[model samples]
Target: SGSRAVTIDTTPPGAPVITSVMDNMGTVTGDIANGGRTDDTTPTLNGTAEANSIVRVYNGTTLLGSVQASGTGAWSYTPTA
Candidate 1:
């Protein structure tokens, strides 16, 4: 329906942080100009992170939730509204 810019914090090496962020809830529809683009899917989280690392989803400096990283240095998370 609309676009939202997700700010990712990448600082304080000793602390858990976000390296990169993507725009959330963007419009993706199949139309005449787009040719074949559609909005039937969402983004998937799949990556490796350090143990005890915390992944936080935010809406501009507001901490949404904390996701604990796996013991094998892997953390995958999906944010829900």
Candidate 2:
């Protein structure tokens, strides 16, 4: 009989931080901060996560989209709807 060893990764990635949310599709194109508003339907989201990891964006439990983080742990996404 032969025995085999298996390895598993249990470490979790760092928490993602949303740096900015920009509205580039509307007349007021800029970062929406401090409880600001925008007419743009598809605002761009910029953030950082674990390097080379998958970042998922959600809105009230509904997933908008997913984007892979860069080698530097940076990621961005813009939803179509």
Candidate 3:
């Protein structure tokens, strides 16, 4: 006789919210407005997601990068290019 235990999660995490986008490479570094423009090549993105979840950042259809959310559900990502 053999026994095994397994666990499954069906509930999905809440949608991520982009709190702010900062131009780290710009001469005048600051947060970029919702529809604003920037000359920064590698901007920093701040957001929130489910704790310990994988947060993926994308540009239109292209995947930029992925980061793990902190225990408080906070995450940040900066594109390399």
Candidate 4:
């Protein structure tokens, strides 16, 4: 199957307030990469984007998974690798 281009309004959906992001080392920053290599293979990723929007977690170009933001703009994605 081929892919079709779906256009989405690139306008601001309001400033998404990412409150917290916790890992095995406790809370970390949001909207930025803030970790080095760790022994933990599975880590819980949490954040807040535009509510009801989809949040995709990625390592470089590799997409880990996607999580739907809650009604309160809260989202979490736990990686298997």
Candidate 5:
């Protein structure tokens, strides 16, 4: 009862991938890349179909974050990575 053991994995995960938005029309004001989070800034949605809709951020089809346009017209996210 004087010995202990533990195991850990130290392999770094792959980076997230940024893909084209579905039906993306207007130029995104903030960073549109994967893991990109915007706050207090509205993306220029001149021709965007759904301006105030829940957009899903992903990495090679892996769901990352769901950004929603707030009352202040901004998107916020706290990435775990």
Candidate 6:
């Protein structure tokens, strides 16, 4: 055996993109540039993320919902009013 040094690098997950947000009317909206807002209290949110990563949806400090990205890095979540 010989003396050796090993270094471990740690990196956090990347931020998930809220690419699409659905309104209560079931209409689909575009990306965050769309502001992720709607008149309806309950709406579905869809986005892309690192595969298998957790995507947490929030409004200010309150958490709306959470979802896991699929192998293809696609995810969707809907919150209750």
Best-performing candidate as measured by TM-score: 3
Candidates in order have lDDT scores of 0.53, 0.90, 0.90, 0.68, 0.43, 0.77
TM-score of decoy 1? 0.41
User: How far in Å is the alpha carbon of 12 misplaced in model 2?
Assistant: 2.1
Native-structure RMSD, model 4? 9.2
Q: Could you give candidate 6's per-residue lDDT for residues 3-80 as a string of tens digits?
A: 999987688668898777766553544343364456656667788999988888888999877889999899999888
**Candidate 6 local lDDT, residue 49:** 94
Cα lDDT tens digits, model 4, 1-81, are: 999999999897764444444446435522334644444456676777887988877789999888899998888777885
Q: Model 2: per-residue lDDT, tens digit, 19-67?
A: 8999988578889995788899989989999999899988899988899
- Flag regions of model 1 displaced more than 4 Å: 1-42
CA displacement after TM-score superposition, residue 30 of candidate 6 (Å): 9.0
Models 1 onward score TM values of 0.41, 0.81, 0.82, 0.60, 0.31, 0.69
Q: Backbone collision count in every prediction?
A: 0, 0, 0, 0, 0, 0
Which 10-residue span in candidate 2 carries the lowest summed lDDT?
26-35
lDDT comparing candidate 4 with the true structure = 0.68
Better model by TM-score: candidate 2 vs candidate 4: 2
Candidate 6 clash pair list: none
Sort by TM-score, best first.
3, 2, 6, 4, 1, 5
Where does candidate 2 stray beyond 4 Å? 1-11
The sequence of per-residue lDDT tens digits that candidate 5 reaches over residues 1-81 is 698787887865333222322222345344454445444233322112133556555559898667664543344443334
Worst 10 residues of 6 by lDDT: 24-33
